[model samples]
Target: MKSLIVNADDLGRSAGIDAGIARAHREGIVTSATLMTNGPGAEGGGAVARENPDLGVGVHLVLTYGRPLSDPATVPSLVEPDGGFPVKASAVIGRGRVRTDEVLREYRAQLERARELIGREPTHVDTHHWVQEEPGVFTAFLELARESGLAARPLNDAERERLRAAGVRTPDRYVREFQHPRAIDVAALLALLELIAAAGDGATELMCHPGEPDPELERTSAYAVARPVELATLTDPAVRAKVRELGFQPITYGDL
Candidate 1:
């Protein structure tokens, strides 16, 4: 049997985003989402998660785009001179200044923050900007998942092998192209469903960023305009019907 987990990322980035995620899950095929615990809308996002108990909420761990939950001083290698994270993942991964210990500490803090706000353990863990794919960071990320006994997102087959070898749970495949603006349409989504159906057995994760764009999102995110388009496509009844037609068992990360 084939299984699919449609996980929307960046849930706590803004109120617009939180609203979009809620709608996507409630009226669409989004079975899971990853929360940006440090984002401005985190508290509201947590409320949404609680209200929708079936929505699997996970930690969208950050090494970029916000201040660290751990004191900046303690995670100096992970932050900039101004105590905020670099705006891009490259700034953190390419600098070679990141400390594995610091990454572990800061990630733990974020996970704890999510637990506190959501009033329960997150269903899984994934990264913002895929930062955890970096070599040094991957070690710490894998360690955290193992320790926390949480499912994780693996960007590729190698990462999947590593996570499995480390006794971490993860989907068998990951699909990331669905979030692009050009692909945020019902036809594209239906095509994606067909592709997943053809891939045969094993669970697959389709990563998406669906949200209602707001002024804050417009200012902070370059991909803001594509959000509502994704939201609309994701919430379309046709997409949900296609999943059922293709015999793709919809699942959440917690079910991995």
Candidate 2:
């Protein structure tokens, strides 16, 4: 049977987002979520995790958004004057502003924060903006995952191969939708589901960012409007039923 893991990213970005992730896990098709260690709603996300033990939680290791868990002095190249990371992933990777050792240290700090807040080690790890795709960065991240005995999200074929070479496991396939803000078309999401169903065997991960709109999200994220639409798509009865109709088994990151 084909397995699917609906992993929601950015669990602790805001209270609204945290609530949406909780609803998606409890009432919809979401099987897992990735928590932001330094997110504004981290406390709420921790509460949600405690309440819903069945919902597998991973660390959404951030490198391009919000504040870093590490000291700004130590990672001067990775932080802005405001103490948060640059919004663009290229600013860090393309410019060679971030050091590999600094990245490793910051990632470990974020993992530690996640463990403290979520009350356990994260089941897996994923980057905030696909920053792990950068050459040296992914290797360091893979090392961290291996040391922690946790899985990491493989965003593409190359990343999958890299993970395989390192003896790390990920879902057999990964699916995600990239869209402009407020343009989360449900029809497109459904089409993605159909495409994944028609593909080869083994487990696949469907990544989504779903949430309710609120002041915090509006202020912090440019993708705010798209969040609610994504939430609706995930919780839609039709979509949930379609997964069953396609004979897909919903699993979590841990299950990979």
The Cα local distance difference test for each model comes to 0.90, 0.83
Per-structure clash totals for the candidates: 0, 0
Supply the TM-score for candidate 1: 0.98
lDDT of prediction 1: 0.90
Tens-digit lDDT track for model 2 on 1-256? 7999999999888888888899888888989999988767788888888888989999988888778888889987778988788888887666756778888999999899889888876789999888887766787789888888898889889889888788787888887753455245667767777889999679998888888877767976787877887888888888888889888988888887
Best by lDDT: 1
Clashing pairs in 2: none
Using Cα atoms with residue i matched to residue i, what is each candidate's TM-score against the true structure? 0.98, 0.94
